[model samples]
Each structure stands twice: as C-alpha cells, then as structure tokens.
Target: MIPTPAFVVDEPLLTLFAGRFEAALERHWPNSILSYSFKTNALPWLISHLRNRGVWAEVVSDHEYELALALGYPPERIVYNGPVKGRERLRAALAAGSMVNLDAKREVEWAAELGREQPDAGLAVGLRVNWDLEARVPGESATGAAGSRFGFNVENGELDAAIARLRTGGVRLAGLHMHRNSRSQSVDVYRASASLAAELIVERGLELDWVDIGGGFFGSLDDSPTFDDYVGAIRECLVGAVDPARTRLIVEPGGSLTAVPIEFHASVVDVKWVGDNRIVVTDTSRTDLDPLFRRRRPFAVDLTTASSATVPTQIVSGFTCMEDDRLLTLEDERELRVGDRLVFRNVGAYTMSYQSTFIELPPAVYVRDAAGAYTRVRERASVSDYLRGNSWLSPES
Candidate 1:
C-alpha cells in the first residue's frame, strides 16, 4: 500500500550532500569544522549520522543542546546560539564547554558572570555581527538582514562596544560570527561576506580562532545554482581573504545539507470547478505540507497516475477553511482525479520545521534507507496526543 500524505527522506541523497560539504570544508578551511545546524532537522537519527561523519552540532536552544548531548556531541564541538538564552541553559552550556555566540549586550554580562562563577571553565565567547548585505538575486530578500532581530551591527559602534564590554568583563573573545541574508545561487555574495569578515577581524586586531560564516546556503532546488559551482565560488572568495593556516572556518549549513534528500507526497482527493477556476483538493494543507506556498516559492511538481491524460488550467488547494491554503496553480489544463499522487520535490528544509496542525495535524514521516526500503520515522499524531497535558479537560479526570 502507498503511504498517505507523508514526508520521505532519501538517505543516500543526504549522505552524498554531506560528503560534498565535507570535501568543500577540507579543500578551503583544511582543519576547519562544518557543523550541521540542529534547528533545521532535529531528528535524532539524522544528528547521529552527522556526528558519526565528524560534523559538529550547531544548536539554538536548550532542547537542541540537550539533543546534541544525547546524540553524543561533546560540549566543545557544539556551538550554542540564539537571541534569547535562559540563565540555567546558559549555565548548562557553559559548564558543558560549548561555544556561546552572544547576541545582545545582556548576554555579555551573563557570560561574564558565568566566567566568574567558573574560573577555570575556559569559556570561548563569540559575538554575532549584523552585516547589511542585500540579497544577491534581483528582487529577492532574505529573512535576516540589517533590520533583522538577529546579530549586532559591526558597521556601527554596536560590535565595537560589545567586544570592549566582553573584554572588560574578562570574557575571552574567541572569534567573529556573522549570519548574512541567505544567498540564492550567488557565490559572489558568500565570497563578499567572507572577505568582509576577514577585513573586520584584521582591523579590530582581534585574535580570531573560528570565523563562523553562518548558514543560508541554498539546497538542490530547480532555481538554485549547482552545488559544485557555489562551493567553488565560496572557496575562492574565502581563500583570497584569510590565511587558512591561521584561522579555522566554521560553516553552519542547514538547508543545503538536507533539502534535496526529502520528498513530500499527497494524494489528490477531489477535483471540482470553483467559479472560473478548477480547484483540486488534496489530503494535505499548507500548514502541514507546504507552508512555503504562502510565500510564493516554487517547487517541482509531478503527477503519478495510470492515465497520461492532461487537464486544462487548474488550481491545487487543501481542504481547509482558509482560502489562502492553496499549493500550486497549473496554467495548462491538467486532468486530475481522486487517488492521483502529487509529488513535491526538494522539501527537506523549512517545510516540516515550520509546519503546524492548524486544522489537522500533519501525517507521519518516513525514511527511505540506502537499500530502497521505506520505514516510518514519526507516527501521525492522534487526537489524544493533542489532548494530553492540555489543562482544559472535561470534568472526568
């Protein structure tokens, strides 16, 4: 029997992507490290695979920190980051010997306190800088930019002040970290950021260890540039700037390492004419399957059916109350029927992470192993799963 509306991860494809990234890191940074951002895909199995292959963990929260630990990542190999970190979590990370990328001035003080509390902890602190670089693609804008809620503006006095404050507080400055806007198939953008980072380090006279050019690398999407070409561009730009022998380059890649290896498939349930448009309803919704559809991002779509017949122009939508829960619109008439499979390619990244169970919780997720067998990873959530621990329960305790 075919799987219902589910997410399927291609293990071989993911392994291949990881190998390419490892090769890139070795070629450019040599002794540098490539940490897989855990916030992207926190699946324990996936993290274990990365750890086994020498990829470190980049965590943004306490749960992720715990997950990394559970996955056997030593504190030294894990990089803890995020805008808001609780005191207890900070203490845990500090004690574990993880590198904490301080976002705000408050964290600087917190780190100092932690240092004082644990004199011999040897805490290495890095500051997140805000580099105001526009999206390389014309008319494209990344989620993080100058006005973004993340990082400090190094161009302004903010970075300088933070560094000085850390120095005053007796916090050892390790290196500089900048997460620019995501670059789409533009290696020049990556190179520019790398070069600018090196210049900033030199100008500040800061003893830098690891330069974290944070993740935003595009995956193997139809519109994205080839991975090899993008890697070449980044290498040229980075190598031309800093001496690889002196500093270690750390890349926190999330999507590029995950997206191409996953597939989302849903079955078309109904096809009907709504006003002048033909609406095809599927078993999936935007909240659970294709949240990126709300942003008008394109994905490769294919139809699986016995008949090769094509229908005229049609619009694909989900069975939800929201009129905005539309997935795709075909300009040509595409004949679809109940039980027809709709396959969405390249959904390994933000899709599942941002998914919600607005109207209905998402279906189960499966993994296709190297031997070409499918096994369930996450079972679909039942009603009881939602009701569990909910405060508003019936009088029947």
Candidate 2:
C-alpha cells in the first residue's frame, strides 16, 4: 500500500480527459496544436503519456529543454518558451530544429547571432509579442501594470525593431506568441491579442509558421469556459488574419488542462481544541499543496470515526510549527478522529511541482493506471534524501 500524503494521478482519467480536451480543440480549430506546458507537471510519466498522444513540449528552461530531448521528444516538436534565454541553450535548440520564440529584445539580438551562425539553415524563428489589450480583470491591478516582463512590447516600436533586426540579420520571422498571466479571464483578451498581432504583421511585413497563445485557460470547470470555448475564441481572432491551412496555431496548456484530473490526500495525525475552536492536524502541509489556502478550490474532508455529534469545531492544520500552518477552518464542527484521510482535489497543478522538504520529506508517488493497475512511480524520500548534496555532511558526521 502507498504511504500517507499521497499525490495520486488517475492515469485512466488522465488519458480520457486529454483525449476529450484535444478533440474539443480540434473540433474548433483543426489546424491547432496543444503543446504541453512542461513547467506545470513535468513528471516523466506524464510527459511520456502526453507526448505519445502527440503533444509538443512547451518548455521554458534549459533543464526542461534538455529533459525533453532526453525523453526522446523530436526536437522539432518542442517549443522553447520563457524570457530568460541562455546563449548555449538557444544555440542547442536552434541547432536541434526546435521552434524558438524570442521573448525579450536582448533575445532578439541573440536570435540575430544564431541566424548569422547558421545562415544557410534559413533559420525560421518566432517572436513573442507582449501587448496591453487592457482587458480588465477583477481584483487585478492592470492600471499601472507594466504588463508581464516576458516578450517584446507591441505598444512601443520594440516588436518592430526586433523584427527588423531579425530580418536584416537574414532570419525569417515565422510566428507570433503572446501569453498573458493567469488573471486573463476573457476570450476577448485573446481576440485583442490576435488582432494586434495580425496588425503588426501587416504593418511590419512579416510571415509565419505558428502562433502560440500560451496556456492558462480555466479547463474542466462546470460553469466556466471549455476547451472549445478557448479555441473558438482564438479561431475567431485568427480566421482571416492567418491561413489556418498553412500556418499552425500552437497552444500551451497548464493547470487548466491538467489540474482537476488529479487529487492529493493527507491523513490526520492529531486532533485538538481551544474552547469552541477545533484544530485537526494532518500529516500534510501547505508545502504539499501550496495553493490550498490561496484559492477557494473545493476539497473533500473525511473524518474517519464512528458516527458521533460530540466532535469539536474544526480548524484543520499541518504538522508545521508555524502558526500559519492551519490549512482551513470549517464553519461547522464535525466529529473528526486521528488517522482519517483528508483528500484535496484540484491540486494536481503545482503541488508536486513546488514540493520541498520543509518539515517532513514525502514518499514515493502512487499511480493508478488507465488499466486499473497500481504502481509506484518513485521511492519515498528518507531524511538523508535532503542531505545528498550538502557539503556539511561527512562520513564522520
């Protein structure tokens, strides 16, 4: 059996959802492609599963780029993203025939150099456009928002200058990319971005291969938008502006596509009360699921105990010594007992991506496959697991 605080992926559910999501997008925009966001859930198994289904790797780091290569991903199927572009990494990606999106103007300079080096390669590249659609989001301060630091500014002549630099350097500007922060809540944001991108292409005399509307859509929400809704919105913007038959539209999806399918479970280890307030300590902490309290995502609570009405008011907490370790508070008190499992859903996004040994190190993750087979993907970490790289540890110590 798997140990406590399990991060489980229903692999069967994953395949089903992925197929459904892909079909949803294809139905709307047949020319579109879904590039899996590696930064979101780069689990090798997860990557392999998606890659086998024909999803491209949308990576933002040198390490992730290398991982994609190591995992047998055809370099051509990888989209190199992110604002920080290391020279060697850029050269490697360019050499490997991966599609590279130049984020900042400095990277525009780098792209020019790469173009000069591989002048005969006829290096076709993409430019990530940073635009201010002024799409309003509640509780977000876009007023003074300088906009995200990634990509070239379209408002100023930065985008034009980058294009000129690349063209003069003999590199073909093949595509446009723009991904807003998660605060972008409307498809209108995409319409505006596409509209502006198309306008710039005409004004600057540019040509392309694919336009990547980076991922952050609210996927699988009952009342929210669906994959079709997002792709439809994108198609509306790109229909006449670009040739769907010739140019590909690449979409990188993250939490929206991958979050809801997986769930995390932490077991209760202690129970206590301070007057009318109840504190239920669990083996898990925010470290396991960082977004637990940050967002109002729904979770299931199981108080493993015989039916009783004498339970204390609930204040679920972690084992951490900090006072802020409280996970959540219940409006009504329930009979809770130690050893009960507390399951948190919609935590599949970054919980594992951001996990660290804050207090107690976690164990190997368990997976229930699509065929209903259970397997251990990783071994549980011991105390020394955290000290493997520490120089302070010695044979004597």
Candidate 3:
C-alpha cells in the first residue's frame, strides 16, 4: 500500500491536458510554440515526459537551463528567461541558438559584448518588455502600482535604451517578450499584453521572427478562460501587426498545465480535543500543501474511508511543531478518524517545486498509469539522502 504523506500523479490527466494545450494552439495559431515553464514544477520525469511530447522547456535560471539540457532538450528548443541568468550560461545559450530574452541590465551588457566578440555569428536575442498592466486592466495586476520587477520598464526609457544598446552593438533582436503576472488571469490580460506588443512593434518598426505573449492564463478550469480564449485574444491583437506566416507566437505555461493532474495524500494519525477545539493531526504538513503559506482557504480535498458521522468543526493540523502548521478546518463534513486518507487536489503547481525539507523530508511521489496501477517515481527521502552533499566531522574529531 502507498504510504500516507505521498503524492500521486494522474498520468492520463496530464497527457490529456498536454494534448488540449497543443490542440488549442494549433486551432487558434498554428505557427506557435508551447514551452513548459520549468520553475513551476521541474520534476525530471515530468520534464522528460513533456520534452518527449514536443514541448519546449522555458527555464528561468541557469540550473533549470542545464536541467533542460540534461533532460535532452536541444539548445534551440529551450527558452532562457529571467532577470538573474548567469553571464556564461547566457552567452552559451545565445551562441548555441537558444532563445535568450534580455531582462536585466547585466544581460544587455553581456549580449552587447557577445555581439562585438562574434560579429559574424548573427547573435539574435529578444528583449523582455515591462509595461503597466494596471493601465490596461485596472486592479488586475498582482502588484498594482509598483509594477513587476522583471523585464525592462517600457514606460520609462529603459526598454528603448536596451534596444538602442543592442542595435549599436550590431546585434539584431529576433523577437519581443511581453510576459506579465496578473491577479485575475483573465483573457483581457493577454489581450492587453498582446496589444502592447503590437503597438510597440508598429511604433518601433521591428521586424520580429517571433512574438511571445507570455503565460498567466487560466487552464482547464470551469468558467475560467480556456487556452482557445487566450490564444484567440492574443491573435486578434497581433494579427494586424505581425503576420502569422512570418512571426511565430510563443507561450510559456507553468501552473496552467501542471495544477490539476497531481494530488497529495496524507493519512490522519491522531485526534485530540483541546479546550473547545478538536484537533486532528496528520503526517502531512503545510510545507507540502502550500510552501509559501499563501492559501487562506482549505485545499480541495477528498476523504477516503472516513467515518459517516458529521463534525461541526475539526482542525486539520500537520505534524510540524509550528503552531501555525494547521492546514485547514473541516466544517460539517465526515468525521476524520485515524487511518483516514485525505487527498488534496489541484496542488500540482509550485508545491513540489518549492518544497523544502524541514522537520520531515520530502515525501515519495508516484505516477498512476491508465490501468490505475501506481509506480513510485521518487522514494521517500531519508536522513542519509538529506546528508548526501554535506560534509560531517569524524567521530575522532
């Protein structure tokens, strides 16, 4: 039997979502590339599977870039993006024909240096444009007025300055990247972003090889904007500016692709009453469910082999010593008893990628096949596993 505090991935569901995304892109914009965001969930198995399925890797760090390469993602197929990409790796990616988007000032300097060093190499790079999302969609941005810390601010002269630097350095920009984070994840977000890209391309008279709209769209959710909705909105905005025949559209999806197919299963270990509150302790911790501790609501959970009796209120707490480790409170639901398994759903994104070892190590993860058979992908970590890279003093010392 699979132990509690383990994760199970629904392989069929993942495959379905992948196919749906590809089809949506094909339907709305045939000349488009779908790159899976690696920072969202960089499980090697998951990345390799997506790589095999013709999905490119969109990485934000040098480690993720190398991970993609290690997993057989060709340099050209990988999208290198982020504000703090190492200079050596950036140069390597650019030389190897990867799509490197210049975000920070240091990156522009590196790009310029490479352009001067290899003047005949045709160093093509993309510029990440930062704009005010609040102007287009009020109150839709996560950081309303402060704006995102990523990309070059276009409202100011930073973006123009970066462009001029690249042009003077004899480097040709291949495309423009306009990826923004939004609070609403609405279709209007993509529409506004694409419109900005279109306006910039027209105003600057840029002949681009590709136009990346970036990724923050809602995926596979009821009453939420679908992939078709997002792609259609973007295409509408860019159709007049860039020809679909020459300029390829690109999207980097992270949570939208991985959120629904995985679940976290934890078993109830003990139940106790303190004063007027009933506390049920489990093997899982908040570190497993919400590593950022951002969720104010309870996780979407399913109880297995639970008692039929209803409870007015019971606090579902984690095994950690931290008092705030309480996950959620069950209200008027089936009474949870010892050995009852609680499966948390829609937790595929950021949970595993951002998880850290604290009181307990990371749990094992299994992938469920179409036949409903579970195969362990990652074993439960042990002390020895955690101590793999650390140096210890000898007993004699």
Candidate 4:
C-alpha cells in the first residue's frame, strides 16, 4: 500500500481539461498557441505527457528551458519568458530560434548586441509590455496597485526607447507580449488588456507578427469565464484593430489547466479537543499547497473508510512546527476521525515545485489510471535521502 500523505495524480483528467481549454481557443482563433507554464509544475512526466499532446513549454528560467529541451521538445516549440534571464541562456534561446520575450531593460540591450552580431538573420524578438492599467482601467487593474515590476513601462516612453534600440540594432520587433497577474477572474480584465494592446499598436504605428497576452486568464472555475469567453473578449477588442490573419495569438497557462488533476491526501494523525472546538492534525505539511492555502480552499474529507465521524467543528492542520500550518477550519460540521484522509482538490499546479523537506518529508507520489491501477511514479523519501546531501554526513558515530 502507498504510504499516508501521498499524492495521487490523474493524468487523463489533466489532459482532458487542458485539451478542452486549448481546443476551444484554437477553434475561435486559428493562429492561437497554448504553452504550458513550466514554473507552475515542472514534473518531467507531466511536461512530457503534455508535450506529446501538442502543448509547448513556456519556461521562465534556463533550468526550465533545459528541462524542456531534455524532454525532447524542439527549441522552437519552447517559449522563453521571465525577468531574471541570464545572458548565456538568453543568447542560447535566441541562437536556437526559440520565441524569446525580453523582460527587463538589460535584456533589451542584450538583444541589441545579439541582433547586431547576427546581422544577416535580423533577429526577431518580443518585449513583455506593461502599462499602468490601474490608471486606465481603474478598479479593473490586473497587475494591481504595487504595479508589476516586469516588462517595459509604456507610459514613460521606455517601450518607445526599447523599440528604437532594437530597430536600430537590426532586431525586428515581431511580437508584443502582455501578461498581467490579475486577482479577479473577470473577462473584462482580459478585454481591457486586449483593447489596450490594439490601441498601443495603432498609436505607435507598429507592425507585429504575433500578440501574446500571456497567461493568468481564469481557468475552469465555477462561474468563471471559459476559454471561448476569453478569446471572444480579446477578439472584440482586437478584431478591427489588428489583422488576425497576420498575427498569431499565444497564451501561457499554469494554475488553470493543472489544478484539477492532482489531489493531496493527508492522513489524520491526531484528533483532540481544544476547549469546545475540535482540531485534527494530518501527517502531511501544508507547504506542499503553496499559493493555494491563501484563501478558502477546495479540499474534501474522505469519509468512506473512516470508522467514526465524531467531529462537528474542526480545525485541520498539518504536522509542521510552523505555528500557522493550519490548512482549513471546517465550520460546516463534517465528520472527521483519526486516520481519515483529507483529500484536497485544485492542487496539481504548484505542489511539486513547492514540496518541502520540513520536519518530515512526504512519501512517494502515486498516479492512478482510468482503469484504477496505481503506479509509483516518485519514490518515498528516506533518512538516507536527506542525510546523503549533508556534507557533514559521515560514518564516524
């Protein structure tokens, strides 16, 4: 039997959801491309499976870029993004003809030199565009008040300066990428972004072969907009302004597609009464659920196998020394008992990248098939595993 606190990944469910989202967008906009965000969860198996199913890698680091290349994805299929891009990796990505989106100001200068070096080719590049959407859209700002420290500032003429440098240095500004991190899952936000992009192109009299409004579009959430809805919102703004026939559309999705397929199961280790309220401690730590534990979560208690369900008001926490390790406080009065498994949904996206080696590391991760067969994909951590890495580890006891 697989150990407690192990993760179960449903590969088929992941593919199905991702495929539906991508297919709908592609149907609406034929030139649309969906690139899976590698920073979300870069599990080799997950990346390889998605790659086989026509998803390109949207990587933020050299490590992730290298991971995609090692996974047998062609360099051209990988879209390199992020602000912390080193010169070597950026040069490599440019040389290999990967779709490279410049993030910081220094990156623009690097592209200039590279462009001059490859004069015959006239290097094609993209700049991650960011404007003060808060001032323009008011309450609908996607990047929020503490504005995104990413991309060129359009209002301040940094964008114009960057464009001039590229054009003068023999680099062709073939694409404009605008990715905003929005807290709201509204279609109006995306529409505003699209509209802003169209307006910018018109104002500057610039020509672009592609427009990537980057990811953070609401995924398959309840009452949230669908893939078609998102595309339609963009089309509404872009239809008359930009020539869709000449420009390709790209989206990089992370939490939306991957959140549905994996479930974290943590066995209840101890149950106790703190005054009148009940507290249940699980064998697992909440660190594995990074970025998800920020709000009212989407996890459930598996009551089928549990012998008793005596708890009414329960506070669920993990086996970590960190004081704020509580994951959920069930006010709904559900039945919970010792050894009962707390199954958490919407956990597939960031778990692997956030897996912790806290007081105690977790067990092996298991993958369940459509036929209900379980396979061990990742091995459980052992003491030797942790001790092996310490330089002080020696046989002298």
Q: Among these predicted structures, which one has the highest TM-score?
A: 3
Question: Each candidate's lDDT (Cα)?
Answer: 0.76, 0.76, 0.89, 0.80
Candidate 2: where is the Cα deviation over 4 Å? 135-144, 291-293, 296-305, 310-312, 370-373, 390-397
Residue range 1-397, candidate 4, lDDT tens digits: 4566777888778877787777777777787778999988777778888999899999998889999999999999988999988899998898888998988888888999988888997698999887766765677664568687888988888888899999888999988888887767578777878888898889888688778888886666455588778887887788777788778788888888887788777788888998977888888767776534565644554433444445557888878887788877777555677767667776787787776787776557778888877787887778878777576666652
Better of 2 and 3 by TM-score: 3
TM-score of 1: 0.89
Query: In model 1, where is the ten-residue run with the lowest total lDDT?
Result: 136-145
Tell me which residue pairs clash in candidate 2.
174-208, 364-380
Against the true structure, candidate 4 reaches a TM-score of 0.92
Residue-wise lDDT of candidate 3 within 224-301, one digit each (tens)? 688888888899999999999889999999999998899999999999888756799999988998999888766898
Checking candidate 3 for backbone clashes, the offending pairs are none
List residue ranges in candidate 3 displaced over 4 A: 392-397
lDDT of 1 by residue, 1-397 (tens): 3477888888889888898878776665676778998877776677887899889999988888888888799998998888877778877787767877888778888888877766676766888977666643332245543355677876578888888777666678887787665535366667767777777877876677777878888766344565556556655665645677877777888988888888888998998997878788998877765665655576677887776666567788887889888888877645778898988878777777776778878678888989889888788878988887775686553
Q: What's the CA error at residue 72 for candidate 1, in Å?
A: 3.2
Residue 141 lDDT (model 4): 63
**Error in Å for residue 3 of model 2:** 2.2
Best by lDDT: 3
| Model 4 stretches with alpha carbons more than 4 Å out | 291-293, 296-301, 331-335, 383-397
The runs of at least 3 residues in candidate 1 whose Cα sits more than 4 Å from the true structure, single-residue gaps closed, are 135-146, 183-185, 221-243, 331-334, 391-397
Better structure of 1 and 3 per TM-score: 3
For candidate 4, give the lDDT: 0.80
Candidate 3 residue 167 Cα shift, in angstroms, is 1.2
